[model samples]
Target: MTPYPRWTLRTEHTGYTVRLSPDGPWAELDAWGPHGAEHGPSALDWSHRTHFITPADAAPAEYLPYGIRPFTGAELIAAGPDGERGSWWEFDGAQETGTGLRLAFTDGLLGLRTVLCYETVPGTDIVLRWTEFTASRELRLERLDSAAVTVPVTAGARLTYLTGQWSQEFQRTQLHLTRGTFTMGSIQGVPGHAYAPWLAVQDTTGEDAPAYGVALEWSGNWHITAEAEPGGAVRVRAGRVPHEGAVRLAPGERLTTPRLACAFSADGLDGLSRVWHRYERRLSGERLHRPRKVLYNSWEATGFGVEAAGQLELARAAAGIGAELFVVDDGWFTGRADDTGGLGDWHPDPAAFPDGFDRFVADVRALGLDFGLWVEPEAVSPGSRLHTEHPDWVYRVDGRPARLVRHQLLLDLGRTDVQDFVIATLDRLLDTYAIDYLKWDMNRPPTERGRPSAGPADLDAEHVAGYLRVLDHLRAAHPGVTVEGCAGGGGRVEHATIARTDVVWPSDNTAPLDRLAIQHGFLHAHAPHVMSSWVTDAPGVFDPRPRSLAFRFVNAMCGVLGIGADLRAWTPAQRAEAAGWIARYKEVRDVVHLGEARLLGTPADPTCGVQYDADGRTVVAALSTGRLDGAPLVPGRPARLRLRALDPAARYRDTASGTTYSGAHLLHYGLPFAWSADHDADLVVLTRE
Candidate 1:
């Protein structure tokens, strides 16, 4: 390893090495497992580097673009006031910061300043990269990427990403990354659920280990691109999808792109994700000193026919089954029966609750559960009084027909009046009711994002800022309130939103089977603690998959547990079983919420599981995909489940069997649990001594 002009950033297990080269700069990696770093590459050569590419026709005195540098996808791009053709930047220098490094480059001719920064936490392999640009004079920027890294991988590497629609989010598929640009993005005001803001590049020539990933933190329009160059080099770029579709810079103006966090793992995709999870836990403080409360929502049980008496019956049932949080979902507000009407109206329906919401909330609280209500504050149905009164409150062009999705028009949250109305409505509700939670949902994406009032203002960026302000303001106003985010589903599950909300509703299709793939994809970039999964009834609103109550409860137990099933329709036996499951979840809820997760297999596999370990406690959940997959069918017999993140010298005992095993045996040899061909699931809990 070189001493000067070259540095290596390290965690206990991984290290990122960067060195200044004749061509520019290049980064090497050590992704070997936590205890092994000598097996990784020491340094990458400059001839294959992926740094900023300068203009092809730069002066001899200027920093010449690397001969092998890419033609496109540079981190900085700009045009001067006189319309310069190309940019030639000179490397100012690099500084070593405690957390990471900052490399400065400037285009003096155009008066643009660019800083490339890198950061890594002590216990995480995530090396966060971001770009900051400042203009000394008036200049226009065409492209300003947050992160652009070129890492050489084995030929025929496979790329995996998540994509889906409204009801279904976080679908997964893998394909060979050939020679071309594979871009997945959304210019739709919000980061649409069509594609997630993360990607993983795996060398298909070997196992899934030693893969690389990149993710952006912005909640607004964003994109992740993976390009396989002709010379077997794979480059990835991620950041905001340009400003207002394009950004214009004035003198003294500055812009910083969203921070792009990346990770490299030698232990497989699971290892890569664990690093991200730890980083998130550091971002969001420890889970509330306690387990996530068992929540029971009144959506599937009583959709739009909710009344005080009906809700009370459901609340009684939910509390009987040991639910700690009771949430009344949509349809309690004025003029709301379905998605067609009544969005902006936040107050309770006087006709549905004759005792006004006060008595209803009080009755629910009397059942020993914190109360929550659902609201879509960013949308307004045309048939609602809110839309009838303020016709111009919705986002639309001067003379264009307002586009409606889910029978709702997008609210021009960019406007001060619209923002004030939302804050006042929610503030009044929080003041009036004894509510503990609010399911903040935006059921549709922003369409016709043009604000008539502001004329040509960039509502895309302003709306996102407004949304963040409302959340922050509400929390500051009522610190006790908890908000669960839902944009149709997992549309808004980015770092920006996750940092502000308590939990996220991953998907509306709560069919136990379908959720496995969705939850698997989601946990790659997000920690499991905030993944709000529900155990809805079979033949769900979308999927017709059938699963046993035990299977369903255990499936939902993978994250924050919520019950949306119709408990009234269940038999006495089912109710008793549900009660038992809820109790078991509470016993080990902290493990699921805060423990490090190591998923054993891919989502396409028939036999897969996730193991969680923290302190001296360990919990492993094994799930079956119903089909045998040609393996030996051993009903009720669990295969050997391996474990990770345990103290090797410690001795562990199973609470249920009273059987003791050394940590070596439990981890290397494994433990046995049983699963059937019909989506059977079992949880193995062990304590160390």
Candidate 2:
């Protein structure tokens, strides 16, 4: 309707609008928010543009090169052979696709063409955006960001993100920005534990305020920077494959950045989280409907002391407790006595499996469970034969010393020969063994990341591409096998990894309370179906508050439940109790995995839990973390938890206690619970009547 050329990308309940700048050749964001936001006043219209700054710097330009946005940050920065930087690009053309639009620009002098892409994810409120560059002549790229998003703000931006260390990952963090730039990312080759590739921004800090978020679909080194300008706008730019210096793009070659997912919710962080979950469901495709197995992993039970007899013993105990899968963890392969040896060697250890590997797998299947194995294909120990045979396959800075984090060096998966070797090893393993599940792990990040053979190449980008290729191969070549993605516990968790892998290990520290807190933050950014939680006997180093077995089972049941405890050591009564819990988990897993998820009070609260609703059924996992002797409950005053997103007009009946209550009463008065020292957790299931 306006004179400017405008484009609107619509989702189920949101809209994003962009318009060609009236004063320039580039495009700028006009509006972005819930449905009908475009019909109202433009939130991003800057009334006062600071003097001395270029128009591109003050405008909400979509994507611009250095010359256009010289003062402010740029999405693309390139140089010619003579070291001349920046580009004077003019609008070339624009094309509309079924999902979204593609806008192209060209710098004839530099012989460069760039296209900014946008695709609204089907059935979701998230918009996937990326950028592509093709050169008629060679260019050195100093920075090639995927996309830059502008958020409307009055005072400043309230940013919420996730960050943590090795055993403690996915810690929800927050920052308030009135001015200056705030940045977070990983430069360690992998999306490290220091920061998750996600960020949520809002104008104000409140539980019910409108919020916007962005997540990068990159597993390699990446950076996300948010700048608050004096013109009352906040621009966020995110990119991948970050390196120490520039990457070269030869003539006729195309360089495409990873997709950056943008989402908006008027109902605050909770709504923003649901938007993310729905997009993840789109990524999962048909796999979202499939049931995640209740498996038993032998990592906590046996560690590196893997053997046929011991594994069979654990398998028997696991199967007796109704486990659907049995995975022999590390040390199943030859030379793997400890962390120092047996990586890159995929063959079964003759010493561990006295009987052939086939016999070992068959024996586990005979116990009525599917076989699984743990593998770290991208890692090689100094004592490994693969490292000795192909020293050049590992990443190193030629003459610099390579540092080992877990007594292992990372393979340069960017190389075709190395990728082929990895593919062949995995193919051979799957073909030879009756493996139904594969737990792919990466123990450490790359040190001195360099490829001497391919000089001046973007090693980080190459590795990410190669890693995705192998995953695609597994998905196509071995369709029936389930893949669980891990990186010493949640280092590689992002859209790219989540889209390919079936489930992901949230953390290695499965001590009940700590895991509950970790999973709390994890579910805020990811869906429960991909969250593979385990019940382990490992003592909590963070919170040593001893919890009962029931607490452990209930905590793990919040996601794709798995048991890593030493079942052989559990007594007859304990095992019987576990069997009961596992059976209960199976009954409600469908709703927990595929239904709408709502996180209750946080783990910091006295009582907190997670609730799921689907198909007229609702499940709630309530846990009490307060001191047992701290507060005495007055008689007849039970703890009540108010549920969310329920049909208030309907009547609900509890399946466990056979009690019926009006939905109005349930919503207002909440579900009641009686907590004791021995009974600190409860799993409640209800059906609408």
For residues 1-689, could you state the per-residue lDDT of candidate 2 as single tens digits?
Answer: 78978899999999999999876778999999888888876878876456888778888888999998899899888999989999989998899988989999999999899999999988899899999999999999999999999998888889989989988999888888899999999888888888999999998656677999999999899999999987788899999855756779899999899999999998888888888888888898888887899999998889999999999999999999999999989999889999988898889999888888899899999999999999999999888889999998998887799898899999999899989999999999999889999999998888788878666788888899899999999999998899999999999999999999999998888988888889999988999899999888888879989888999999999989999999989999999999999999999999998888888888888788899999999999999887654446444456778898888899999999999888888789889877787899999999999
TM-score of 1: 0.90
What total of clashing residue pairs does each candidate reach?
3, 0
- The root-mean-square deviation over C-alpha atoms between each candidate and the true structure, in angstroms, is 4.0, 1.4
Output the worst ten-in-a-row residue range by lDDT, candidate 2.
Answer: 628-637
Residue 516's lDDT within candidate 2 is 84
TM-score of each: 0.90, 0.98
TM-score of candidate 2 versus the correct structure, residues matched by position: 0.98
At residue 452, candidate 2 shows an lDDT of 82
Clashing pairs in 1: 637-674, 638-673, 638-674
Q: Report the backbone clash tally of model 1.
A: 3
Measured with C-alpha atoms, the lDDT of residue 558 in candidate 2 is 91
Q: 374-444 in candidate 1: lDDT tens per residue?
A: 99898999988899999889877778887778888988887888899999999999988998999998877
Per-candidate Cα lDDT values, in order, are 0.76, 0.90
Task: Tell me, by TM-score, which candidate is best.
Answer: 2
